[model samples]
Target chain A: MSTLRTLGSAAGAAAVVGGLVLVATPATAADTATVSVLHGIPNTPVDVYANGERLIDDFQPGTLTDALTLPAGAYDLAIFPADAPDGSGEPLLEADDVAVPAGANATVVAHLEEDGSPTLTPFVNDASPVAAGQARVTVRHTAAAPAVDVRAGGTPVVEGLTNPDEATLTVPASTITADVTLAGTDTVAIGPADLTLAEGTSTIVYAWGNGEAGYDLAVQTISGMHSMPAGVPGGSAGLADDTSSLPMVAALSVAGLAVAGAGVARVARNRG
Target chain B: MRPAAASAVLGLALAVGAPTAWALTRPEPAAGIPVEQALPAPAAPAGAGDLPALPTVTARDAAPAAAVAAPAPARISVPAWGVDAPVDAVGIAADGQMELPDDVSRVGWYRFGPAPGADGSAVLAGHVDDREQGTGALYPLKDAAVGDEVTVTDAAGTATRWRVVSRQVITKQALPLDRLFARDGAPRLTLITCGGPFLPEFRSYRDNVVVVAEPVP
Candidate 1:
């Protein structure tokens, strides 16, 4: 649990600067696409190849790669065992002539099918701006498990989610306790874990692994869709004005002190 | 001058005693998994893949270096104004407004925005004056002159310096939020506090004193 918390902090910190977005350079927007890779095939540490060239080496299960800015085009993609001498041998998974659209933000996953066979799935990510103070959370079911319901803070947000399928919701920014249960049943399958939905960002959670191996969660965050606050209400009293009356200041001073004393007392009460 | 001194005294007392009251009210820390470490070379080698043509990947102008994550800012100091205070992370309120700390002494750093040293505008706001706290730590921000330096220290104890570039007291309705809370641009530091006349009906100041600063080389 602590390890997950630490990892969360590290990832959160990395995107804290106004939410990092996988943006295509404006000048080349018509020619480029942004892509990230997630290796969710449990028990397999493999090398990822694109067009017969190794793009990632010894890629571990449940690991997600940083975004790559690639020119928009079609290419053969393959995955091979880590110890494979070259791309000449039969690949564990292969997809031919995968068309990558220009200016697209996508995630390609190597994961298990509903029947527990390994396969590849590409999903177009939602990067549109979310409402102010709200966050977008997308959940993808890539595990071999049966259909399930995803509950946030004890309320089911995604129902009857199936293998290689996804559900998305925009919610308030907060830390919520989330769990997955067998569809329409109280039987918990995974988690009662905490998920933080930060404002203006889209968080994609992947439920991966097979029924035989046990399921785990992986996360990918894309930021930069934040909206401005309606306003900043910074002051209440009229004390900052130069013409403030002496008698009012004196009166407020006493009141302020009393409030300060009460605050300290409240802290003491909380501590006790 | 007398009113300012009286308010300063009131501010000092609240600054010393008020942080604990609001600390208990903040939400829990959120969670995320560690970002993946392996990065592919920007482009595939020419003629490597069976495709119509060799596709090359290039670096994004707006993306930060994915390898090293910058730390969050923990404190801020403006020696010119004798302003130094701890910062608390804050987000948007349910009302679709920026949530300010209940404690007037501590500044609120907009968590969803860029951090102080990151490549965008980093916003730090404080109350100008409140009923419980007579004056805020950023009350002197309106008086900040161009060339004054504001220093922010991150969690790792690295202090980044910013030089005051401009100051403005615009009406609250006309606040240039897009520029002040920008997510993409050169690194900048933005300071905000209440100013102008306070309205009894609204219980808010009419204007916001905004200070913009650029990174100091």
Candidate 2:
């Protein structure tokens, strides 16, 4: 989960067990708990974790969602940025003692800020489908919270509501997928609009970036927009991997050492 | 000159300072909120056996072992279990991971773990149990006696054996940072493994039973 891995030659700690991509081994019995991440973060290094393990590490901001495999149990969920949870990255958005039961889904949304703290909210939305090349996005902050500036690409598109509970973004018909942004700080690549707009599809809208740490960003596609994924990409809707459970220092040191061990120990001006 | 010896091994139940709780985070921009709350209190996590063994590991993945021919650091003999695996000087992998010789998989020695005979706390680690594949050298560590002879080799190539003073079944979560990392400064060796009746469902041993060996010679 260290950036040094990206620069130097450090083999990813990603261990491929038995030749299988060691993805999250969800709880045996499908728990009713479903957790989704919607962040109002721009240009962030994702570090999402569940049950205290390094699951996702998208250490570069982009809007997306990823599902997790966990046994139904009480979990302490958190989100942070790459390179730090200690002042270097955003503050953690944690839901203490969240219970995930079998066959149920648990949805938790995190909003990011430049100050690096969190104001989390439990986002609830029904599945609505959207069509390809055409998009319908909705965002709202619960209980008259902060205002967030939403951007379509790098340009400002929609402003998050403070007391103005609902906001929406409709992409042009000639679009493939657009990057969704929260506030001015968070941005993510969202949607490969599927089907025809006239052919309405269901997309479950989950927005979470409108609070103190206000900017929980997520997508709410027109129902059935293309084959709607079980959840957003990049692991848990907008829940960028932003937790301290993953070691950044240890990883950086390992990478530096790997380079030094490779007979390049004299790369003076080394910055870990 | 070598540092002066501190307390006798038996008398030293090394008191390692509580490790500082380091908050882990990524390199993303903060979502824009103030963090006024003190970090959640550090916790010694439980339910370790339930955790998976580092998704995967090398059987003897301690690659590019340092100075292998340098005779075993000290003689490690688990009298009751009948193990007499010789300790050797190990080093970091080419990748910088603590690596033991691939030739001697599951053998324990104090690399950066603990020192052999110094004023500081030392460590000893061995494979919990192994044969050719299933079990290797530290196979009998599960049943080692209270007073088993565990010799540690000094940097000068002298052997200093210790007695297995205590055995503990510590979950991986509550790994004793002080004892394993040795911040308090005492010489010791911590034998380790994923052992106890092997759990088929879990695909690993019950807990890592550590045998703290103190210098006797």
Task: Candidate 1: list runs displaced more than 4 Å.
Answer: A1-28, A81-85, A153-155, A192-196, A236-272, B1-87, B102-106, B130-135, B149-162, B171-174, B183-187, B196-206, B214-217
lDDT of 2 by residue, A58-162 (tens): 533324344333445565545666666533443354444544454333334444322333444443332333432234544444322345554434555565434
Q: Enumerate the candidates' DockQ scores in order.
A: 0.16, 0.01
Q: Which candidate has the top score in TM-score?
A: 1
Query: lDDT of candidate 1 vs native?
Result: 0.72
Q: Which TM-score values does chain B get in all models?
A: 0.69, 0.53
Model 2 TM-score (2 dp) = 0.28
lDDT of 1 by residue, B1-217 (tens): 3444455556557554344434454222211111011111123323213433433332122111122335778899999999998888888777877888878888988887889978778889988878987888888876877788999998889999998877777788887777677776577888888887677798887888777787899
Interface RMSD list for the candidates: 18.0, 29.9
Model 1, B3: alpha-carbon shift in Å? Answer: 40
Put down candidate 2 lDDT per residue, B11-62, tens digits, no spaces: 1212111111223222222111111111112234233245342222111111
